[model samples]
Target: MSKDYLSVMPEDFSDFGLSQPILKAIDQSGYTEPTPIQTQMIPSVMEGRDVIGQAQTGTGKTAAFALPLLNGLRQKKKASPQILVLAPTRELALQVADSFKKYGTYINNLKVLAIYGGEEYSGQLRQLSKGVNIVVGTPGRVMDHIRRGSLKLDTIQSFILDEADEMLKMGFLEDVEWILEQAPQQKQIALFSATMPSSIRRIAATHLHDPVEITIRSKTATASTINQKFLITNGMNAKKEALGRILEVSETDGVLTFVRTKMQTVELAEFLTELGYQAAPLNGDIPQNQRLRTVEQLKSGKIDILVATDVAARGLDVERVSHVINFDIPFDTESYIHRIGRTGRAGRTGEAILLLAPREKSMLKSIERASRRKIEMMHMPSVNEVNKKRIEAYKSRITKTLTEDCSFFDDLIRDYCSETEASVEQVAAALAKLVQGNSPMLLEEKKYERREKRERKQPVGGRNNRRSSGRSDEGMERYRIAVGESHGVKPGNIVGAIANEVDMDSEYIGRISIYDEYSTVDLPAGMPRQLMKVLHNARINGRMMKLSREGEKSSGSERFGNRKNGGKPRRSNPKTSRKPRTASAV
Candidate 1:
């Protein structure tokens, strides 16, 4: 127990003696009490002492250091980057900068800039030249500026390394070390990370001088307020329809749906929009200004749903986001935590629904273990459920309208009934019919069932991989590649190579078998000639994999084919043939 590193248990933000401006901003932001990290670490940071904090995601770590850094800044007329915060990703950089701005709203002439890759240099240069009080940026982009002489570090008083573990994992340790070394030696240092690996500890020991170490271990990665559930589904189209049905039935203020790829985000957003849902796509490709506007629109209720990739949705915090739909199961538990974290923020109740296939049940278990929360199995919303929800909403709308003043509408309705020589009841029924529009109120359960079945049905010889395995279905042609076990060519390798070459999902790929000298992959029929040519020259295991359809004799086969027993016919043994372990689609 070092005297300078005493533990604290503050009841509220006021206990930390934060400046009146910061306290006011916190109150306006609706935060009543400081989170554990903030309560434990803010005091030390504000006292100009070095500190190291270990906290999980969504634990309010940003505010822990941001408030203290802002309070420590002197109210000077001329500013030149007094505090430098290095974040791992662009999203985190921008988010940390936003936190600084929010907490220091009352501080005069306080300028914060977030520098990251993928943006024009002109804007960043302009901001740097104009002078900023604080600069938060990713390590690589920050190094670029430091090298270009655009960013000055001499005026820095406080240096912070946010998400140190993530920066290390992303191979930014060298750049981070370079930046850390460049900063003034006497400056106060604060390092925050979710995990404290030896490498992080080494840096902390070397840089931080008798720093107060505060560790806040969360029982689980996910928030307690989130209602986690999973719906078992199969196939891409079926999952899409199931998502639509879930969106139709759930009473959500706004939804953030997570997918695996940027292309999926755009396609799913487009599909939902076509179905009359107000939806938009958010991904790395979208410009930063547009991304900002899209988020604002989501918060303002202009968009009901957002389809986005994991990279795009990082650091996204919106209060009205009532639901998080994992349209595609996340590849890892960490990503799952981050995806669901979009909701259930600031103690708001949120719904996290995952579209899981039978094969994905194992991943669900992994997530449960990682988050330490059992995800309840949720039944798919049936047609009856959807119709009931719709009818309830319709009735609610009618009740609300009835409660409002409608004297003018009543007279118009009476006049219209008189002109048509119709009874009041008949006129009211006609009006109701007109309001419902061409879309049917009730969906046919059997119709959706039939569609799912039809989509699953394979061509005469085609076999659906989800339901069956082994042997290419009819119409799926077998192609041979010049790499196999001897060349360390695994099923994953072949699947990845073909999928990457053509932008096709691994699930869409058929069966695969590898021979000692060559391998065979089952692909959909009718591959474009140009794509085939491109894949033919594709390199795998440092060898040019020349692909050709089976039964097409190639001169290279007899010329360079591996013959195990001096060209003698090897016995075709079923057990010896390589059947691939299922490859997951990204």
Candidate 2:
């Protein structure tokens, strides 16, 4: 099948018998066709069969399961919940609940409640007392409600475990199993997870009865429509400055910047606004009305930039978003995909730019691999580029006002030129200088270069001095750190920790080899034993280092024991590979 044929189209929603209101909501949300998960799972769900869905985070899985559950609800059904969804995180619960509300808009007399931690429980209790048709909640809170008798699942006809693997990882599998036991034995169960490990499969085997399995894998590892790129920065402040420079240079109609924390969403938005950009923060705390308005502003050009956390920005569709900026590198590869997906949507081409402190280069590589696309290197915009863009913007503004409000500004400019005995060209030049004064654009070239130098100077290896040691072509014994793959260590962490602990240039760090459990990096061939000991004692990822040879042992042996040895080899476990050694002797 052609790539486009395999992908979800907007028209797929038509077959679902969605009421006009729900249809309108979907259309407004920029969904035209159903995703594969939606297409295959929706029908099965509406048929009231338990479903087992395997799809990644960005595959529109929420709507896939939610729409069908809503469709199955009878208009006359009692206020007690007909469906319950258990999610791993509070943010995920809220997101799923919002999806339910949006898709069930036309389902008359339907009520949905989202219950999660860190919120007032009295309001939830009141909602429960009034009765609701659907409840989306985190595992812990749902268990609490069940214990308190505030939540009664006797009438629930459908149950869903979203992000089942995540819940398992968070040690909530016991709670999930307990909750499942509490539900009626006849209830339908739907379990969705990106990756189904043995534990997840067991849950499916025990709960779903001969369930139809649907798996949709993206043919192209990464969204081909997205242009991914990255810029290297020194630290937090330099990253902000570089972001400002990029915003000025990139030709984007609207931009969505992803950050790791809710606090960062606010702080980054504030910084952008202070720089005279139309920017706003979108987070879970923002009222629904305000969030909708912010999204509208972004689409309509009232706001040019949006800073948001991954969860808060879920289900947002703004076709005009031409660029996605990763202000903070995501915690995982899946998040990276979702963040960039905010752009390059609906067959539109978009650009995704990632800002990485010197140490984060390793994570950047992982992101590139996970997305299955090469992320191009983007040089931090130079002072000259910023200045050039500023001049262009200034001229454009002047030209627009001159044409649209000629009478208002033309005479004033003329009067000023005449009174000062200066030519109009000279007057305009002076005005331009005044307008562009003291901005990042006017910063000295040396300042930018110095900042870049500092960024490059930051440490580039792992947290501890567990340098990956290797021999150079000249037979020089080179000692480096194994801060890379072994402990999920990113280049940024390596660089930051090294620079902070030892006065060394991040650039001096040589080639790095990242393995699942450990990484081998090249550094200066010879270093004092005491310095190497200091590095070993240093912590990365909050763990001490015990460095080993890079590529010296087969990664396969480390990961899976040799079958020859009764499947229990004596070598180190790949999953627990320690840090690389700084010196060969060590």
Q: Can you write out model 1's per-residue Cα lDDT over 209-253, one digit (the tens) per residue?
A: 989888776634346989999998766767888998998898899
**TM-score on alpha carbons, each prediction:** 0.79, 0.69
Q: Candidate 1 clash total?
A: 1
**Mind giving the per-residue lDDT tens digits that candidate 2 earns over 1-91?**
0112264544658788865767777787778778667877877888888788876655678888887777667665458888999987665
Winning model by lDDT: 1
Give residue 393's lDDT in candidate 2 (0 to 100): 82
Q: Find the candidate with the highest TM-score and give its number.
A: 1
> Which runs in model 2 stand beyond 4 Å of their true positions?
1-11, 15-30, 219-222, 234-238, 253-274, 278-321, 345-349, 357-365, 403-409, 412-420, 436-443, 450-459, 462-586
